[model samples]
Target: MSSLSMDKIVELQAWKLKELLKWREYLGVLVEAVKEVFNDRVEVYVFGSAVNGRLTVSSDIDIAIVLSEVPKSGLERARLVDKIWSVMENKGVPWWYPFEIHLLRREELSLLREAKFTRLL
Candidate 1:
């Protein structure tokens, strides 16, 4: 059996949600930075545990960047991801806050919906 009781689990989950809510402002800043670079060609979404009410202690917030066109080269994609990471870091996102940035084309939005994702920006 688990060490945590049902009430304890509920409390922990609520705490996780509260912790995630605190980071939404930083996420807004990130969205603006990406928008500055991509203009209207970008849309940002927050999916996975953060949006699905299944956040675990180890869950990393998942961010999806939906664009008109995803970079074709892996190197370009890596650079873009790195730049976004830098923006988050500069905006005071702590290293301990686990998160992921994914690049996708407009066509992939349907897939995100199928996977039960939510848009943040």
Candidate 2:
């Protein structure tokens, strides 16, 4: 903590507070967004720095989305990933830094590692 400048500390606190206050609201927005394309077969989670309370204002939001229905082929998976990516990459997103969205299928839960994920939907 000593190494961090006062301004940086203040920035981190503000960012943490913003996330704390809006996390549920943000998750609701995420649910609505995912439901538009994914229907009820998806789960959205907040993970990484945000989940662990180490986020700075500039730290990216890390997310993991798990689809209930797994695509059968590599091409299909790629397309699914692309579709979800497009949804996440929409320009109107509110965060200061771009989010890292990990799109996976139920069978790929093993892909999540070291991330402390909190499921929102």
Candidate 3:
């Protein structure tokens, strides 16, 4: 069996706290970018490990962008992604940020209800 000393446990916790703080700041910038790009047309939510407090150094920020009207085709979705990326890039958000964006309609929001999430916009 293996055990961690109390000091080691505290050290690990402090590291996690620092990581969480970075993610929170990143999320704040993300929310602002979404607002600038989509205005009132979409609602954003943070889900998965980020919202559930299972955050780790390797965890990706999972976000769901609830749209008033979801794109109906693959090409449309791709264009939506491009538009968002363009706006985010213009706002100084890195294109390679460790995050995933899920585009959904209001009706589809029910599918994610089983997951822990908090509205960001």
Query: Which candidate achieves the best TM-score against the true structure?
Result: 1
* Candidate 3 residue-wise lDDT at 60: 79
lDDT of 2 by residue, 51-85 (tens): 88886656667778887676678787767655654
lDDT of each: 0.77, 0.67, 0.79
Relative to the unseen true structure, what is the Cα RMSD of model 3? Answer: 5.3
| After superposition, candidate 3 runs with Cα above 4 Å error | 1-21
Q: Can you write out model 1's per-residue Cα lDDT over 1-121, one digit (the tens) per residue? A: 4656877888987887667666566777778668766766578888887677776666777888998888899999999887877777777876556678889998877777756676767
What pairs collide in candidate 2? none
Model 3, span 1-121: residue lDDT tens: 2356877877876876665547676777777767776766788898999788887766778889998987789898878767777777776666766668888999999999899899988
- For each candidate, give its TM-score against the true structure: 0.74, 0.58, 0.73
Q: Model 3, residue 48: what's the lDDT? A: 92
Point out the higher-scoring one by TM-score: 1 or 2.
Answer: 1
Residue 80 lDDT (model 1) = 87
